[model samples]
Target: MAETAALAVTPAGVATRRTVTGMLHSWDLSTGVDGPGTRFVAFLAGCPLRCLYCHNPDTRYLRDGGRTPAEEIVREAAKYTGFIHASGGGATVSGGEPLLQPLFTAELLHRFKHELGLHTALDTSGFLGGRATDALLADTDLVLLDIKSWDRALYRHLTGRELAPTLAFARRLADLGKEVWVRFVLVPHLTDAAENIEGVAAFTASLGNVARVDVLPFHKLGAAKWRALGLDFTLADTPAPTADQTAAARAVFAAHGLQTV
Candidate 1:
């Protein structure tokens, strides 16, 4: 369980010794595709994986963004409570990887759930899912789990990480009956392999808590970011998956009795 901490904001506006603080990237007051309804999304900074198609490459570094108190973030979100609640919406903590700052994430979720009475969600790659504590999951209402690829080799090539940990986390979430929405990226010749899609769809279908699936079409939307960062944009020439291709990928999930969009 997370214990309450005594704290005060420092002269620099950083909250000191009060619970935990995370590098704050930015916030979106309203978003539809992140979770269920309209959501107040907090994009934290930092990630463990070097994903090739990452749009916000700037967030790859820990503390690249200003260090902010979770309390401050929740207090800000409290302002939108009325609109969010009325719309059957709530707050989501997304990130380069929220679990990378597990304590901050847990404290933020706990505060919002108890103090502001918000329906909290976590959007993660599940790479650092092992960092999540029971208290964290207890406060989370839903999980937007991103399973980038199914095949281990492809997964490694895509995100510079293994697939086992992600799968383990997903299985754990399912075992706990936590509501989850699975997200997958469809990249031509990379992740769009028929066998890969089938493997992912089948695995997700086997999970009891997955309520929906999102087959995201790959795009070069982030190529500029990669270029700006002086990082090689390997997928710079990769085109977005066609509608027919996306539909075909969805069909794989549908065959496994899962609804995808």
Candidate 2:
């Protein structure tokens, strides 16, 4: 466990004092998938959703993670500063759902941007978007928001949560002019309905701040994790979207004049 009593700056550039700590699942380096260029992604613990195709079920609970100080994470990310900068990469605070711990998430974003001089991003389900303070959003260069489903009922069925919050958050981000990358999982016989995809695409396009849309194909990569966790992997038999299916989904977003990847 790590802890830090460091002064952090607000979006206004005013200094504030606080003791910041967070439950960390782990950290890794990745490119393209996370954000522009390469990135050092911190996978925080805990989440508010149980998406059927979640790849990291181990991060579902806060207690399952290690307590680490904000400074500790900053230090670790600093080690990659040169590489990240050279590659035009940055740092991303991701999670089971980052907004589940807004304060800790805010602190990390602040340090990643101000302290490490890295572009900062927040990857969240947007279910807890209300928790993210404006100051926090101010520090985030981009938001990787997951909009699980456009149909309300399917959303509830898929994530065991309502979709209203995510939509509301999207609207708010648009109002704030926040840069966003909307991510949707395309599952065969599940979220593959054209109307469902269109709903998401249309709504995302309506949000002027959205930079792009990611039509991720749903897969059973996390089935083994669910089995290990003694939880049912309902999507085990679900097939990944074929290349044509994926392209069609991307075309939906493209039709809305939004970039897809």
Candidate 3:
């Protein structure tokens, strides 16, 4: 499978605001996995990594979609503030990679946190984590950080990008005492190596601010997306990790004295 060409930033249909307007893709009213509770997920367009397992292949490009204003998005998400707050969930700015568009993502997060008083979370690969500003981290209440693979070489092979940027971002988040939930996808032969998992467990455990560790079992649910995009689904032959594998991973993290989910 070949990687995507280069990034292309689209500006058409963008909605302007006090700061910088954003080029948005779509939004979901509520869901459970994006954050703590029922989250109103805003799937922003544009990302730097080409992960083989990305479900939202459509969002990889920075093409224009339903480009709504950040304030407008916050207003729409605010409608469900009561329900989300009652359930302890809030709004999440997810992406291809939110950090790819640092200004717009930060603006959206800031409004969701201060204007609507909602708990804000950013679901990201952390590949573009260096783009994150201090203000953005401050507005974000939680980070659903995807640490793809522990081995630097494996990380590049798995995500088609360097691993140092993500590690730097994780260190910065920990230094700021930002709450984080480290997400690791368990693949069959490619990434389920015991040593690699141990490496990830060790690194995440070292971050004292990590509130939870979510060991995700790999799945081919995104094969259809790849087909639709005419892009290669590299993990089409990969099997999802079994329950026992997942349990064992959880045990590994638990042994490191880190909470697991």
Candidate 4:
């Protein structure tokens, strides 16, 4: 669990400060991918799933990250607010599953939305979606939801977790009328099956709030990280989907009447 500093109290026994902290992997600025324009992306550490193609395998454990206060992260983002806003970008609280540290994630989202005055996005696998509170979702403007596979068995094999939770979460998000961008990574010989892609496309299209679908091609960018962590990169030889294959997958979503990217 991420550590939280004890609340400071005044002489009258009134609480003055309460610092919500969590394990933070790192943060960076990115455009076109993370969200909107240019985003100040906070990559919180600790995830519930063990995805086979995770590029940031080093962020799998909380111990691998530094304990960071929510205020500190907000302050850092505040610095780039001008640039971020100018670029039509915002702040994204991503993970090792930000929902793992719900309180900290909430604080950051609230501050980013109210204090920093920026669009907020939550990039999550949605496996821990139940952990997210309504208030947390209220502060979020967009959700970058990853629905890795449509096949339950394939999803389990790929992420070491069931796909039901993610599906349920997607439904919940849809019911709430929240804006969402569905992300699907197309892995050759794994998630590239037509049926698998169709399953994802059909579900995403059925969600009224889904704005677009991102058919990301699987890549081995994190293979070296896995090697450095002394863990086997299982998909080391699994080739990335070809352009034609990726386009075909996007066509599936487009056929379902979803805006595909």
Q: Who wins the TM-score comparison? A: 4
The C-alpha RMSD of each candidate to the native structure, in angstroms, is: 4.1, 4.1, 6.0, 1.2
Q: Extract clashing residue pairs from model 2.
A: 2-69
- How many angstroms is residue 195 displaced in model 4 relative to the true structure, after the best TM-score fit? 0.7
Clashes of each: 0, 1, 0, 0
For candidate 3, report its TM-score: 0.91
Ranking by lDDT: 4, 2, 1, 3
**Considering every candidate listed, which one attains the maximal lDDT?**
4
Cα deviation at 244, candidate 2, in Å, is 0.7
Q: Report the Cα lDDT for candidate 2.
A: 0.90
Across 1-261, the per-residue lDDT of candidate 2 in tens digits comes to: 322356788999999877699899999999999998899999989988988889999999887689888888899999999999999999999987878778889899999999999999999999999998999999999999999888999999999999998999999999999999999999999899999999999899988999999999988878889999999988888888999999999998999999999
Q: TM-score-based ranking, best first? A: 4, 2, 1, 3
| Model 4 superposed RMSD (Cα) | 1.2
- As for TM-score, the candidate ahead, 2 or 3, is 2
Q: What is each predicted model's overall lDDT from 0 to 1?
A: 0.86, 0.90, 0.84, 0.93
Q: TM per model?
A: 0.92, 0.93, 0.91, 0.97
Q: Kindly report which residue pairs in candidate 4 clash with one another.
A: none
Q: How far is candidate 1 from the true structure (C-alpha RMSD, Å)?
A: 4.1
Candidate 4 lDDT by residue in tens digits, 70-179? 88999999999999999999999997888888888988999999999999999999999999999999999999999999999999999999999999999999999999
Higher-scoring candidate on TM-score, 1 or 3:
1
Model 1: lDDT of residue 186: 92
